[model samples]
Each structure stands twice: as structure tokens, then as C-alpha cells.
Target chain A: MTPYDYRDLDPLIHSRIRLSILAILTSVEDAEFTYLRDQIKTTDGNLGAHLRKLEEAGYVRVSKSFVGRRPVTRYRTTEMGRGAFRDYVGRLEWILHSRPMDADQREAG
Target chain B: MSEANARQQAGDDLAVIRRLMEDARETVSNNGWHLVLWGSVLAVAEVFDYWAESGTLPVSPRVVWSTALGLGWGISIPLRRWSRKHAAVDSLANRILAAIWIGCGLGLMLLGFCGARTGTLPGPVTPGVMAIVIGTAFFASSSLCDRALFRMLAISWWALGSTMLIWPHPANNLVMSAGMVLFMAGPGFLLTRRAGKPARMELVA
Candidate 1:
């Protein structure tokens, strides 16, 4: 594979907003809608749009319920999402570490 | 973007993701007040039971334990209701923690009932078994939360539990009381204190 092949990254996941959502969701069991919006520092409209994209991709599952009579929404990553994220991270790491050693640094030894 | 620039951005993105994951993990709080409340109640009961057995009180030692258990249930029911009302999200970590404590509580209750029926459990043996159960719960929770403090507490419980098994009478009861304070109530309070603070960002090396 070509070194640092940015084109190879998953279009759905490579976007900054989606990546942030996946990153947060994968870390916990689940999180509320307000919590995600607050942490990602995005408008409700923007986050809802991105979350919809991720949900359509089957990377996230959203459930709605009531908490003390108020509607509550929570999000969690699916098994498929977790696997895809792991692969994405692995590819990124491989790209970063596979860079050839600098000639100057080699010569310094 | 050029290969060099692509690599740079990739590394930066990875770092940001790592930081976010760490923060999210930290936010998965386990309500520790339950542990603290139960531990305090049980410790008091144990001490009072010991005192009553020593002829310091005119009442039966059973009265102290029954009263303590009744008070514990009364207080815990309201505390649990309040927490549930305030909680907006029911996360997986919380569920796992709840399951662990619930299983432990059920097991203890079963053990007590069976022992009472069969007359197999001695007073000194009860504390040792309890310590082992508490230690197991702490160990599991520590691994799940990635916290070293709970692991250390688990070890403490195991060691203290073994000692309690070997000792008898007032000494065993005292050790059990001390164990509740140090391992359960102490960590519970620590969790409460830490809850108010913002999670620190951890970056990948």
C-alpha cells in the first residue's frame, strides 16, 4: 500500500465530526444526546445530521426513552462500528510509523 | 494533501480521538454513595453486635443487626430513587456495576439464610467470606474502570479477610468493622469527591 494513502480512509468515518462521535461512543457504554453535543461543541442541528449518517451506516444505535417525564436520547456504538474504528486506527498508525527514517538522523549516528 | 501533510493530520486526529476516549471513559461514573452508606450501616451494626455480645448492652445482638439492616434498606431505597431520577443516561458501565453489587448482595443474603437454616456458618467465618466477596467485586470493577486504587483495595480486602478467618470473636468482628470503613466507605467517599472534578485529557504517546 502507498504510504499515507489518505484516499484509502473510510469517507464516512474520516470526517472530523463523525470521527469525534465514534471516538466518544466507543469509549463508554452509551451517552446522552446533550452530553455528546456539549462535548463535541457542535450545534444540535449539525450533530443530529452527522449522527443520522453514522446511524444509517449501522455504526451507531440511538434509543429514545423518557427520564423523569422528559424525553431522553442515548447513543452507543455497534460491534461493526467498533471493528471499523479499530481498523481505521490501525491503518492510521501504520501510516504514521511506516515513514522512512530521515537521512540526516541516520547520518548523525 | 502531500504524503507528509497527510501523515501529520492523521497523527493529530489519532491524538484527538485518544483524548476524547479518555475523557468519555472518565465520565462513566459509578455512584459510590451506596457503598459508603451500606458500609457505614453494617460497620456500626458489627460494632454494636460485638458490644451486646460482651454484655455491655441489655439487648440481644440480633436486635442491632436487624435494626441496622432495616435502616439500611430504608435509606438505600430513597437514595436509589433519587439517583435514578437525576440520571439522564443509563450507561453500560453503570449497568455492569449494578449487576456486580446486586449479585454480591443476593449471594450474601442467600448465604445468611442457608447458614441460619443449616447452622453451618460460624460468626468468625462470616466476615472472611464477606471480605472475599467484596474483594472480588472491587477487582472486577477496577479492571473495568482501569483504576489502580480499586485493585489495591481489593488486595487489602483479601488479606484482611484471610486474617479475619484465622481470628475469633471480638477480634474478628473488629477487623470486619475496620475493613468496611477502610475499603468500602473510604473509597466511596473518594469517588464522591472526584465526581465534581473535570476529567483530565490523556494523550497517546
Candidate 2:
């Protein structure tokens, strides 16, 4: 088998923004929508768009409720999503660890 | 609207949201953190009492680690997030309580390994008693952190430890260990499964 396979990997989470979203959700038991929004410093529309893509991929679960008068939303990672993230990170590590020797090393030899 | 006004409005909204989220998170459990803080103290003390009674641990090194697994499953795992929000103990109390428990464990372990007394027990009973006293103080001062159920396995540490203090027995440790595995760790295992589930409103309360 190949050392690394980026193929069939999640493009949605590949983006820096979505990656952070997954990272944060996976760390905590659960977090609120505004917490993610504030941390990511993204507009409501942008976050909503990214969340929709993740939700569609079944990587995140989102729920909404009302706290007294205000609407509330929360997000958390799925088991599959968590596993995929770990695998992605492992692949990244393998790539770095398995880099080919540079021209300088060849010349030195 | 002017940029200044927009900024002001956004700042106000941020403040409001932060408070709301904080409150929502807090509702995960009641003042249980205080109880947990006390519970840790109680755990350390219970360890000491075991030393005092046995002049040594009833179980071997492997058993001690296994018991810890059951205790954490029984007490620590289920209540961790609940403890995080309860804020029942002030920062001073938490650090002190945690320190006392950790110190008690390490101290006894050291005394035992060093063969300081060549006895069944390790460490001075005084330290363990002091830990219990401090823990009781914290427990008494704080209101119940959460519902009895919300506490899950942590309650057993308090109950079983106190029981051992009153009436010493090897059987009691069995009870304590059982309580930890059945009550504390069991729920935490279930919660871990849930943690991976998509965050939803129904789970918030």
C-alpha cells in the first residue's frame, strides 16, 4: 500500500476554517455556535455555509434550541469524523517523516 | 450605520452571547464541582485510612492501579464536565484540595517504597486525617453541585470513604471499588459515546 493517501480524504475539513471547527469540537464535550463563531472570527453566513458542508458529510452534529428568549445552537464531532481527523493527521506526520533526501545530502555522499 | 455604531452593537452582542453560552454550559450540572473537589480530598484520605488500618495496602501495585481505573470510571469521568461548570469550589479551594489529594497519594507511595517503617501501613495517619478534614470543610461549605444522578459515580467515593472511616474493613474497599466501577465509570463510558454524537439541544440540559 502507498505510504500516504490523500485520496478520498475530506476536502471540507481540509480548509483551515473547517479544520479548526473540527479541532475545537473534537476537544470539548460540546460547544455552542457563538463560541465557534467567536473563535473562528468568521461571519455568521460563512460559518453556516461551512457547517452545512460538514453536516452533509456526517462529520458534525448540530442542534438548536431556545434559552429563554434567545435561540441557541451547539456543535460536536461524530466518532467517524474524529477517526478520520486522526488518520489525516497521521498521514501528515508520515509525509514529513518519510521525505526523500535532498540534493545536498546526495552531493555530500 | 456608522462603523463605530456597528462595532458597539457587535461588542454588546458578543458579551451577551458569551454569558448565554456560559450559563447554558453551567446547567450541565449543579454545584457538583465542589463535591468533586471534596471527593478528591476524600479519595486521598481514604487511601490514607487504608494505610493506617492495614499498615499497608490490601492490594498490590497492579491492584492499586486497577482500583484507580474503577474509581476514575466510577467518579472522575462522569463528573468532569459537570465539575468544570459547577464552580462550586473557589480557585483556592480547588488547587488546595487537588494538591492535598495528590500529595497524600505521592507521600504514602514514597513512604511505602522507602520501607520507612517496615509496617503494613505507609505515611503518617496525620496527613490523611488532615486531608479528610480539609475535604469535609469544602464539602460542607459548598452547596450540592448537581442532582444525585448528575453526580453519577462521585457520590460513592464520598459514601464509601466515610463508611471506611467509621468502620474499617477489607470488604469496605471492595464496596468502594465496586461503587466506583458501577456508578462512576459506567456512566462516563456511556457519556463518551455520547460525546462523539453530534451536539444537540436535547443533550444540553
Candidate 3:
């Protein structure tokens, strides 16, 4: 059995809201602020807080522009963010997949 | 948190993330009315041109085509506006698909105009060129989405286009008409029908 390491999980991407934002951004080119809020089912303030964290970590790029008279903010995952997401998800998958084997070994011992 | 409980929570979070990704991917679905509209219009125009060219119709082939083009524009302009207005969310895939078809449409129109001005477009090969243009768009769209059916449709179009190159003028139009109904309009209607239903999201394995 391989050793399980929780320390490998990224602290920045470990939270639910941040993970949700990354996951949603991964599947699309870019998404509007309202769209992300609606998809994540969070209050605007909360979504903004999480997005700010991600933006600080350089995991997302936020662009502000106007469509006619309305100002729009859109978020997209950066290349660095995509790499981090892949690694984060990969580690999570390994941990989840290895748990049953570790449990069986403990029982056999 | 205890180690075991923490591990369990991590697993749960991962599942939630996967589900969220799946749902996000499924949120944008195209109804494909544009495909049906253009396919039907083109098919009708081809058949009408054949009739006019074969001396069975009193009107010039140019008049028939002009009428078809005018009607196509009339319908397409409003429909596109309505679609943009009603769309719940715009995704990258939708934008790319629109660009592919619109670019192809403009390219074909330019080619046709050039050919007509130079008198280089023989009647027999018109369907062939149209088929190639439509096939290019289908191939591009199918590749973008990894849709096997549309890939097959693309191949079918190439084959139909090849047949058009060899077939005589009126007969080639008949072939194009049948091909449009069988390959183009048929799939379009199916896509529109499917889009009307609730999408069943499949989790990535």
C-alpha cells in the first residue's frame, strides 16, 4: 500500500467555495460574476471573498469591461490555476481510491 | 478533526467538485435550429435552381436563388436575435460553434460571388462546393465537441460533394436535395428535439 499524505493537498484550493469556482472555471473559457454566484449558490459578498482569495493566489484572472452601459466582470482560470487544479484533483482521487485498501490492510493485520 | 473523518470529508469534497464540474459543462445546450433553417433553405434553393435551369420554370435561375437568399436572410436575422435574447447563459462552446458556421457562411458567399462574376461556377459543381463548405463546418463543430454523429455527418457530406462533382446539373441538384434531407435537416431536427428535453448530466469517470 502507498503512503497517504494529506499534506500534499493545496491549502488554497481545499475549501468548498474555491474548489467550486476552480471546477466551474475549468469547464468554460470564462464566466460572468453573476453566473458564478448563481452556480456556486453563494451570496455575492461570499463569492467575491472567495474570488478575491483565488485572485490573490494567481489562480484566476478577472476582467472588467462594459457591455453597452453595464459593467461586467468575468473570471477565467489561469494556466497556473489549471495546473494546480489538476494536481489537487489528482491527489484527492488518489486519497479516496487508496482508503479502502488501507482499511483492508489494517483489518488483515 | 480526526484523521479518518478528515479523510472522509476530503472524499466528499472531491465528489462534490466532480458533480459541479459535470453540471457546469451541461448548462449550455444548443437547440440547433440554425442548422435546420439553413439546410432546408439551401435544399429548396438547389431544387428550384434545377427546375429553372431545366427549362421547366418560366423564371430565371437567378430570380429563384435571389428569392431563396432573401427569404433565408429574413428568417435568419430575427431568429438569431431571438436566440441571443432568450439564451440563459452563453458558453465558450456556443460562441465557437457560432463562429465556425458564420465564418463558413461568409466564405461560401464570397466564393459564390467571385465564381458568378468570373463565370467560373458551372452549374454542376455548385452543390459540390456547398457540400464541402457545410462539411467543413460540421467537421469543425463535431471535433470541438467530440460528437461521433456529427463526424459521420461530415464524412457523408464530403461523399455527397464528390458525387455532385460527377453528376449532371439537374441530377446533381436532386442528389443534393436528398442528401440535405437525409443528413443535414434530419440531424438538425433531432438536435432541436433533444435540446428541448432536460439534459441528463453524466459524471466523468
Over 4 Å off, model 3? A1-21, A30-87, A90-109, B1-31, B199-205
Q: What lDDT does each candidate get?
A: 0.78, 0.49, 0.77
Q: How many backbone clashes does candidate 2 have?
A: 13
Query: Candidate 1 or 3, higher TM-score?
Result: 1
DockQ of 2: 0.02
Candidate 3: docking tier: acceptable
Q: Model 1 segments beyond 4 Å from truth?
A: A1-3, A41-46, A56-58, A78-80, A97-109, B73-89, B116-119, B201-205
Error of 3 at A45 (Å): 14
Error of 2 at B53 (Å): 27
What are the chain A TM-scores for all the models, listed individually?
Answer: 0.88, 0.80, 0.85
The model with the greater lDDT, 1 or 3, is 1
Writing each residue's lDDT as its tens digit, candidate 2 over B1-205 gives 3334433433443343344343333333333343433345334544644554575756554355445535644664456544544221123333444454445445544544444346444233323233344334334333322234443333444554565566654445444434434543454354445433333321110
DockQ of each: 0.33, 0.02, 0.24
Question: Model 2 chain B — which ten-residue stretch has the worst lDDT?
Answer: B196-205
* Best by the lDDT measure: 1
- Per-residue lDDT tens digits for candidate 3, residues B1-205, read 4456656866887877877776666554463788788889878977887888898888987788778778877887788777754554456787787788788877877776677667798777878888888888889988555368789999999988877776746578878888878887888887777655542332221
Chain A of candidate 2 gets a TM-score of: 0.80
Cα lDDT for residue B133, model 3?
A: 81
Residue range B1-205, candidate 1, lDDT tens digits? 6668877988999998888877677664557788899889988877887788688878886678679878987888798777765553456776687678778767876775576447697766877887888898888888566478889988999998887777755657778898899888888888878766644543221
Relative to the true structure, candidate 2 reaches a TM of 0.37
